[model samples]
Structures are given as structure tokens and as C-alpha cells.
Target: MARCPKQRKKAVIAAVSAYLELLFNFINLLLRYYEALESEQEQAVEHVSSWETPIARQLARNSFMRCIVSHGDISCTMLVRMNCRTFQKLCMLLRDEGGLRCSWNIEIDEMVAIFLYTIAHNEKNRQLQATFRRSGETICRVIKLVLRSVLKLHSILLRKPKPVLHNSDDPKWKHFKNCLGALDGTIVNVRATKENQERYRNRKGTIGMNVLGVVDQNMEFIYCLAGWEGSAHDGRVLRDALIRPNGLKVPRGYYYLCDAGYSNCEGFLSPFRGQRYHLKEWGGRRPRSPEEIFNMRHSTARNGVERAFGILKMRWAILRETTWFSTKMVTKIVNACYLLHNFIRGENGADVFERLYVDEDPDEETEDVDEDLILHIQPTVEWSDFRQNLAQELWAARSWITS
Candidate 1:
């Protein structure tokens, strides 16, 4: 039954040869992987060298940095929100000038890319991490670090209003008083959360964000109040603005316009009864007299506030996002947007309202909100000599309250 010696020897030799070949193949694969990693490192070094040159990392981001920095430092998240080029230059400048410490070891671009993809779009952080191959905590760290950087210059950036209307007839805002601008509030739609459903419930019976803002006659946001819960009354919001004595200072002889919800005083003004008693019990539906015409003019002028609010909502549609963020962060986000708006506009780019303020007629061809329809708009009196006289006649003149 024994096999031939030549046949057994041939089988043993074949098995040994196969094992040797497999070992060689595995060794080749490992060598190739090392070579690939080396090449990647060389490419990274080249990229950093190009960016390190005196040449701007990104002109747009650099320009934005230059502009905003005049006021103070800005956040990296905000910088990332800048155009790609802008972010590079901004980060470069921070490395060069800010003496800021970078906590994440990744290149500025990776951090910028992650945040840019986030706030600019409504994508979740998890999706961003997958696409960019980053961890959740790293993403969170970069965002917080940038916001903290931006907050440092808050004093210089978020300052009190000074009457820049240096002259009564200055061409700039043309005779607007101690007023930095008119103050007002609006509601943004939000999603209801289980814990705060009852709290954020608006009159429309849906959850939403309520924001209060102050803008100049030209529609530039001078300040804002973003922390109030949506369910808070407008009166309560106005009162809060007053309480921020150090926060929002309305210079003497300056004032903010308000609807009836606000308590009328010297620093603030409201229209006479106008034959209409209140919201539910307003008078018959029509503008019948000169007083009504005056009221129409008053409401027409104040519509600027509505226009400003509309632009803000339009700019950051995410304000309409249903998810909840900490109220504190939400407020900062709102301020950040306001500052950015002024930043991008680059000096009067968005001053249509300001132009409309002093002009008797900017758009003659477009019909003024149908005169007949004007009846529905409420009346508000300017708190100048006219307000004083009207108040005197009604014996409701308020002399106690002063700005």
C-alpha cells in the first residue's frame, strides 16, 4: 500500500513553497501602506507652506477680519461661517495677532470646514462629523472656542448708543434726536418642546421665538433683546429693556416707539385715544378726520421697524428651525447675525429705511398702502411738540417719565 518515494517528496515540497509565497505577499502589502502614508505627509507639508507665505490665506475672510476687528475680536465659528478664503485669512491673522490658544490639534481649515457646513446650512453635527471624519466632542470644542473668542470684544463691539446725529440737519440721518433708533419686537415661529410647551405657547397657540430689537432711523440694529421667552408679553419685554440700564442706554431726549402695550412716558411715546379705545374695543373701521390722517402718517413711518425684523428673519431662516438651543446661545446667535449684517453691508448697504426716513417721497409710483386700507393701521403720535400738545388737550399728558 506504500506510495512511491518520489510522489511523497513532491507533495511536501509543494506545501513549503506555497507558505513562503504567501509570506512575501503580506510583506509587500505592508510596505505599500507605509509608502502611501509618507506621500500624504509630504502633501500636507506642502499645503501648509503655501498657506504660511506672507500672501493672504483668504482675502475675503481677511477683509472681513480687518473690518470686524476694528471693533474687536470675532469667533472662529463666525470666521468659519465666512467664505473659505475669509476663514483662512482670519485664522492666519489670529495666529499672527490674537495670541489665542488653539485647543484642537487639527488644521484651522478642518475646524472651519466643520463649522461652515454647520451654521451656514442646517445640517446636524453628526452628519458633518461623518463627512469630515471628526469626533463629536472635537466639533463641539471648536464651536465653543470660537464663540468664546468672539465674546472677548463684546465691550467695544456691543456698546451703548451715542447720538451720532451730531448736527440737527446732518445729511446722515437728518435730524433724528437722541434716538439711536426706534425699538420694537416681533415673534419667530419655533417648535414646541415637551417641557416648555405651555411656556413658549404664543397667542397663535404655537411655540415660537420672540425677539426684541432696537434700530436707528436708517434700520441699522443698534441693540437687541433676545433672551425673553416667547410667551412673555410685549410690555414685559419693554420693561426688561428699561431694566438693562447698563445694557441699552437711551440717551436723554432720545426715545423708542412702541405700540399700546408699552407704558407711554417722556422717553417713550404713544398716540392719543384716536377715538379707538383698545385692541378689542377699537372704534368704527375708517380714517375719517385729520387726526386719523396724522395717525396714518405715524403708523406709516414706524413700519420701518417691521421691515428690519423681516430682513433679520429672512437672513437666518434657521431662526425658524424647530429644534431648541439654550436660550443664552440663541440670544448670542441673534446678536452675531445682527453684527454680521452690519459687517457685510459695509457702511450703509442696507439703509433703505434710513433713506426713506427723511425723504418725503422715495417711491412715488408705488401706491402708499391703499388709503382705504390705511384705516386698519393703528395711530401713534410722535413725542415732539405735537405729543405734548395732544397730551395737554386730553389732560393725559405724561410729564413724570423722562429718558
Candidate 2:
């Protein structure tokens, strides 16, 4: 088995050569496997992209959905929705007065359309996102921004309650020269958590918010107080309205015609409790007494507030539906609606409704004045005498009618 030294050396060299060749082969195989994996990954990426929609096409679709033609469809009903020209005026106010043009570069027309659509249809944020071709976040942000902007116009939109001059010769208002306006409360449907449902429920067994409002002769809201519990009495709500810093303020010699739910105090005049007060009850017959005549006239004047509320509810469906908003937010929205109602009435006049009152068109049905629900506040001696004297004056003014 002994070999020559040269032969042993050759055999060792051969084994070494074989081991080196095997290591080189394994390295080449690994390099080829990595190259194949990278090629497969590139192909998968290309396949995925081939099925994707083009960015330009998607943008075109969004533009078509939010085009001017779409807005025209909205404008068709803008009169009943936002009382006609009010929608345009509101957008101008936000863009110019509220500084929205500087703060947010969103289109002013689109902003107004979004806001009115929300109120008129009572739409949710997600629903608006789809309709406006905007993201949910943008829809929410725009709504909040526009709402605050509209509220900034509150001071100017709210008209100051002015007294009728003694020498004024307007027949419709000459009879009640000292009257400031009509005051009343209306129930607006709302939504709340189960724990708070009982507190928000009214006598009608529905969740609601009690909204107290005062409207001038032109059907413009002078003062609005919202957020009261639905279960609270109308008189209690009025008391709270009086205590607020900007609450109702009746100047001396000016009174508001209210319903039986309010106290017949010096600043507020209510109809005779035991007598017929509604115009329907009179039914074309002459009043039997001075008190009956006063009640008839009081009912006629106080109807301004009811007509305002009716038009308001008809314009904004949000007031009629149960909104999925917190009670506080709902209150703010209610206040915004009142301010907008005043803005519309001031800008467009009182043509929002064809016949606001039942008496205006006897064929039209309207809200009846509730004379049975009496607040138990005892009238002051001076207050009682003032009402009695007012009734006598109204009766004495009948010389023109009788003649």
C-alpha cells in the first residue's frame, strides 16, 4: 500500500480540486434561485397594475358627479328649501363677510349646496360625502365651518323690535299700536341616548326639544331660545328666556300677544281663560262682549309666531325629523335654523308660504291656538287692570267698523 511521494501528493491535489469545484457549483445555484425570485416579483407587480383604474378616469367621474348640472337640480327646489334667494345671499355672506374665502378655498357654491342639502334632506355625513363627491372628513369639516359662518350673521339678521309710531296709518297694525310681537313655543323632534330619553320626551310621548321664539309682525324672529327639555312647560321655558342675558326685553307700553300657557302679565297679554279665543270659534259672528272681541283680535295677532314656525319647519326638514345628533348640537342647529329663517324672511319677504294662516285662506289647515292649557301664575292687580283697559280701548275703536 506504500506509494511514492509524488503519487501521494497528486492524489491530495485531486481531492482538493474536487472540493473547490463543488463549493463553486453551490454558489452559482443560489445566485440563479435569487434571480428567478426577483423576476417573479416583478411580474406580479405588473399584473396587479394592469387591472387598476386610471387616476385620471377616477377624477373625471368625481367631476361629473359634482358638475354644475347637478347643482341645477338642487336649485330647482331651492326656493322651498332655503326660501329662494337666501341660498345665494348666504353663500355670499360666508365668502365675503365670514372670511371663508380666506380660511377655506372650497368653492362657495358647493359649500352652500352642501349645507342646504343637509338641512332640507336631513342627510347624514356619509350620505353627503357620496352626494357631494367629497371625502367624509371634508364634508364634516365644511358643514361645521359653514354653520359657524352663518351664525356670525346672527346679530345683523335678527331685527331690532321697534315700536309702531303713533302717527302711523297702516290699517293692519294700527289697531295694536303698542304690540311688539307674538311669542310662543314649538316642539321639535330630536334624538338622545336611552338614559336621557326620558328627560327629552314630551307629553306626546316622543323625544323632542322645546323651542321658544318671538316673531315680529313681518314674521321675522327677534329672539330665539332653544335647548329646553321637551317635558318643560311653555311658561317655564318663557321664564328661562327672560332671565338669559340676551333674553326677551319688552319696552314700556309694548306687550307681546301670547297664548294661555303664558302668564298675562304687563309685558305679555293672554286671552280670557273662560271665553272663546280662536278665530274658528267666532266663525263670522260679532263678539258678544268686549272680552270676546279682545280675544279674537289677540288670536289674530299671535298667529304670526305660529306661521313663522310652520314655514320654518316646512323649509328645513331637520326640524321635523329625529336627528342623530347630541341634544346640545341639536340645540345649536335649531338656533341656526331660526337665524336663517329670519335671514330669509328679511331678504325674500314673507312669500315662503302661500297661506301662512288658516284665516288667510279658509280652505288651508293650520295649527290651532291651544287655549285650554293654562299656567297657574296669578295675575298682578296692575296687570289685570292694564288688560281690562286695553280691551276697552279695542272695543271703543269699533266706531269705524260699526259706522
Candidate 3:
């Protein structure tokens, strides 16, 4: 049964080769399994994503910046800074909440992007609309719709005047005795498009928009009107302040402040005539004395309306002009901006003009009694005369009622 040495050696070599081959095949199989496991694990991670909200659920800047810019931040193109989810929500709100959608199924982001690019940045609608895969008409409609929503939601953000709280507490505004808010006029310039050039022309002899706004001491817009033609005076505009039955509210003893553009008629007040815009003019070497220094301090505090206008116009360049917004939407856009301004200030601490770098006048000139230029003053109603007449009527009426 013994075998030859050479044959045994040959058999051993064959076995060794066979073992090496088997080991190689086993390693290959393990490699394939590991690769498949990795693939499966990746698919699982993709499919089994955690359902909870991501820590980075930030609101898109557009949804927030539009409001902020108008009342407070006064920045341009806040759209680029927003998150995708928030951008989508804004598109949905404009489309769904505001019901502004066109035939193209243009999304909210595209629409908002169009506005931020066009109106806020003063880019042509055709150019911006094209970038977003939308038509110019769609862009126009989108802008109008947003303006409408802004107007619709203007009062929603207003902090109700807290009369119950004492006047001494919130020095930012005028409380109980009188003063609902501030009143002011702003001109929104527009290119004289041939279609309705005359209709848009204002007293300034330019085709522009005239808007009247009322804001509280906090600079929150309480009410706004945008329909008046540019030629309308501030007096006529103020008369209609109490017109809107539901949207407008003015409690008794509450009034507003405006410049000489408005009459000091029954419900409003202005600086004393021969009044210098800056009361410091009174002490100057001018012929006539001006208002006291305290008046300047008070007027400056009440002049938030001018600040609001500057903020709005500077941020949304279109606001400085007659917006292509529909006439009805004109008011809404204005209201919305004011409302959002307030919202951003309250929620985001947005300061519209500070961002714009509004400056104080160091050598600004004030009118000192120009003799050649006659000062037209608003006729005042003597309180004593008015009250005596009112008292006589009351006494006579009482005797008649007694009888």
C-alpha cells in the first residue's frame, strides 16, 4: 500500500492550490455581501428619515421681509435669504390665502421672487418674470394680489390702543385724552403711461399716487387709504378718515396730528402759525419769533409719519411711485406694508429707517418770517366763543324739555 515520494509531493501541491482557490472565492463572496449591505443601509437612511421637524425649519425671508421692510427694516430683496419651506408657504398664502393664481400654475416662490426683483428692486417685470418661468402678466397679478393681502391684513397686526393702561406708561404714543395716531400724506410717483396719465396726476403736476395713512406712536399703521388721485389735498383725505364702517375705529377724545397740509379744524392740531418747522428758529436773529423749543421736541416725536413714508419708499422702490397695483389693491399694499412694518418691529426688532441711514439735519434751514412770502394760517375757532354759544343752546333746550 506504500506510494512513491514524487507522487505524494505532487498530490500535496494540488491540495495546496485547491485550498488557496477556495479561500480566494470565500473572500470575494464576503466583499459582495458587504457592498450589498452598505447599499441597503443607504436606502434605509433615505427612506427612514426622522418624521419630526428639522431643527432648521426657518421661515423664508420674503414672507417676513416684505412686512419688515415696510414698517421697520427697510431692506431690499429679502427673498434670497428665506428657507425653501417658508418660501413655499408664502407662495401658498398668496395663492390660497390671498387667492392670487394665474393660468400658468406659477408657484409662490416664483411669484414672490418676481415681486422682490421687480417692485422692490425696480427691475422690469418682463425680466424678472422670465427668470421665474412666468409671464409678465402673471407677475403683475402676483404683485397686485400681495398688495391686496397686505392691505387686508393691515389692521390684524395693530396693537389695540390700551386706554386702560395709564398714559404715563407708554411714552411712545399719545394715550386717552386725544390722539388716535398720526396722519400724513405721501406721493408715490409713476411714469405717465399713456393709458390713464391724467387720472394719476397729482398736485405736483406729475403722474403719481397719493396715499393717506394713520399710524400710532409705535409707528404701526392703523388705517390707510390709497384711492385718491394725486391732486387731492390732505384736508379732503382727512375728512374721509371715519368713512370705513368696519375697518376704521376712533374712540372719543382721540385725535391725530398732521402738518399744515391739514386744517387745524375740529379734530386735528398743528404747530402755532409763524411756527418754524424747528422751534429752535424762535431764538435765532430772525424778525419774528418761532414756536418754543418744546414744540420742536413734541413735533419731532409726532413726526413718525414722515419717517414711515421714507422707510416704505426706500425699501420697496415701487412704493415711492404709483405702483402698478390695481386701484383697489393700492390701499391694500400700503396697509400691508404698514402692518408688516409693525409686525417685523414687534417680532423681529426691525428698524426701517435706521437701516436706510436716515440722517439728522445739522444746518437745515427753517423759515423765519419771510415778509415777501405771506404765511397763510388756518383760522382758529375761539374756544370761549364756541363754548358760550353751546352753553346757551343747552340751557334753552333744558327749559323746553322741562315744559
Candidate 4:
């Protein structure tokens, strides 16, 4: 059972060497793992730092500027809804009068373009953000800034009422020589909450606002009073307008042609109540009575307001579609369109107006959408005589023509 000393020594040395080798390998593995852990921690810190860094804004200014310059006329008229000269004029107004000097790298021209494009095309914030290469918040802010700027030009855009000189030479307007303009109301669709829906609902069960406007012979809006609920009667709205501090007014000798929705009173003239008055009533048929002749002339002169409304609705699509905006904002939009309509007409000539009216038959002339039941009014002796005299004059003029 006893082993030799030499053999026993050799076995002990072999076991000790094996244990040392194992210890060395374990220490090397620990070092490698620590290095890998340190590298991962460094990478995590780098990733966190990168998120805090801000990126420069990309405005796409050159691209947009080039597009506008390349197709300058189209961009100015169709896209921006104004001629180049007018656009520049507005830009100046926004800077000086509107107090909208560009800040934070937003140019005045860009702000105006954004506002016009948004309303003219009825584009959403997201669409504008994508198109202009800007953020949604930036696009929205710019639109508001330019909107307020454009609205500042209201006093300049809206015309002042002036008397038309009496003339007997032109048959078309000779009878209306003293007429200042034509007055009418239009309905624009809008979105309202359930609580306010009834107030905004029209007879057709659609939410809308009744806008009263007066247009001169030049088809320029002289006065506009919007924000009346669709349920509000046109006559009531007009009455309110007459009482406002800066509302519609007619000089002693001047009057505005109105439909039956308005009462026949001083400073306001209306056609015969129970007679053929609308333009369609005389198509391909001569007027049968003197009252008919007067109505025809009255309707012809009143077409100015109808044509103005048509032009306004055609130019701004935002008015046609129901928008998710507050009632106040919608009212402002309507006013802004009216103001701009006058501005465009003043800047451009009658040809531009005629072109926009092409192929579009005039809408049926009506003062109110819900004026079917005419309200009878007992006119004062003076007003009654005035209307009778006017009608008689129209009849006498017609007799002269026939003879």
C-alpha cells in the first residue's frame, strides 16, 4: 500500500499547476467583461446627449420663392388670390399699417402667402405644414398673424357710400341715378355645436350665417354686416345695421335698391309686392304692366349685389365649406373676404371680374332664403308718395321708349 516519494511529489505538483492555470483564465475573463460593460455605458450616454440637441429649421424658402417667380402671374392671382402689384402693396401695408413686421426668421411675404393660400384653398394646418416645409404650429401662427394684418385694411378696403348723379341718357341706369347701391343677404355654411345649432340652423336644416351686404354699381362692397344667425330675419338684420354706429346709411336724396324682404321706407326702395319682380319673370316676355316695368328696372340695378356675392363665394372656397372654426373667426373670415373682394376689384379691371363670372348663370335674385311670406307694411304718406312717384317716372320713361 506504501508509494515511493518521487511518484507522490510529481502527482501533487501536477494538481497545483492545474489550479493556477484555472485562476489566470478566470481573471482574464473578468477583465474582458468589464471593458465591454464600459463601452456600452459610454454609448448610452452619447445617445442621451444627442436627443437634447436642436436641429435647424428648414423653411424651403428658395423653392417657394422660385416657384412664385417662375409662374409669377398664376402664383400671384390664382394661388395668392391677388395680383403681384396688389400683393406687394398688401405686404407693405402689413408691415407698416398692420404692425406685422416679420420676426423669428419669418418673412412678411411668406406670412401673407401662407394666409392667402390657406383661405383661398381651404387648406388645413397639416397640409400647409407639409407644403411650406414648416411645423404645424408655425403655419398656424403665421396664418393668424397675416389674417389680423389683412383685417387692419378694412377701413381702406370698404368703400364710402356716394350719391350717383342723375342722368337721363343711359336707359339701363337712368332710373337708378340716385341709387347708392343694392342691398341683399346671403347664407354661408358653418359648423356649430349642438347647443348653438338651433340658432345657426337655416330653414334647410343647415348651419349658416346670414350676411347682409351692399354693393355699389361697380360691384364693390361698400358695407357688410355679417354674424347674424341663420335664423335671424333679413329685415331684422338690416334694422340692426341701420342703428349701428358705423352701419349702413343713405343720404337724403340717395337710396339703395332692395328686395321685398325689406320694407318700402325712406332711403330704401322695394319693388311691387304682389307682382312679377324677379328677372326670370320677364325672360322672353315683355313686362305686362307699369309696375312690371319698374320691377324689371329695379331688379336689373339690384343685380350688382347678387353678382358681388357670387364673386366672393367663388373666390374663397373656405366660405363654401363648413369649417371647424369659432363663430367669431368665421364672421371675421366673411368680413375679410368682403374687404379683399373690394381690394381685388379695385386693383384689377372689369375684365377679371367678367372672367370669373364666365359660364356661371346668375343665381336667382332673392333678399332672403326664407322670404316666401312677405310681411305687409303700412308706409308713411311721404314714403308711399315717393315710391309712387318713382314708379310713375319709370313708367313714363318706358312709354317714351315704346313711342
TM-score of each: 0.57, 0.75, 0.59, 0.78
lDDT of 2 at 49: 40
Tens-place lDDT digits, model 2, residues 136-207: 687777777778887787777777775545775644455677677788999989887898889889999999
lDDT: the better of candidates 1 and 2: 2
By lDDT: ranked, best first: 4, 2, 3, 1
CA displacement after TM-score superposition, residue 280 of candidate 4 (Å)? 2.3
Model 2: residues with Cα > 4 Å off, grouped in runs: 1-76, 83-85, 101-105, 354-378, 399-403
lDDT digits (tens) for residues 53-139 of candidate 3: 323112233344344334332232253222334345455656655666654554455556555556565566645533444445766
Model 4 pairs whose backbones collide? none
The prediction achieving the highest lDDT against the true structure is: 4
Per-residue accuracy of model 1 over 1-403 as CA lDDT, tens digit each: 8879999999999998999899999999999999999998766444444344334345433544344334232343243333334456645543544333555356554554444445555466665544444456877787665555544434434434445345645333332344445667777655555898778788888776678887655555667777677899976776666566444555445556655566556566554454542322424444444344334333544555666676555545556565344556666666655654444333323333333433442100111121221111123454456565643433332223323
Stretches of candidate 3 off by over 4 Å are 1-106, 158-177, 191-199, 246-248, 279-294, 322-332, 359-403
- Global fold similarity of model 3 (TM-score): 0.59
Task: Give per-residue CA lDDT, model 4, range 1-403, as digits (tens).
Answer: 8779998999899999999999999999999999999888766443333323334223255467555545576776777777777788778877987788788767888888888887788887756765666666888788777778778888778886655556445445568766777899999988877899999998888899999999877778889998999999998898888777677765555678899988887778888889888877777677766788888888887876887887788888888888766788889888988888887777765435456675432201212222232122335678768887878877776754452
- 2 or 4: which has the higher TM-score? 4
Q: Highest TM-score, which number?
A: 4
The C-alpha lDDT values of all candidates are 0.53, 0.73, 0.54, 0.76
Model 3 per-residue lDDT at 399: 21
lDDT of 3: 0.54
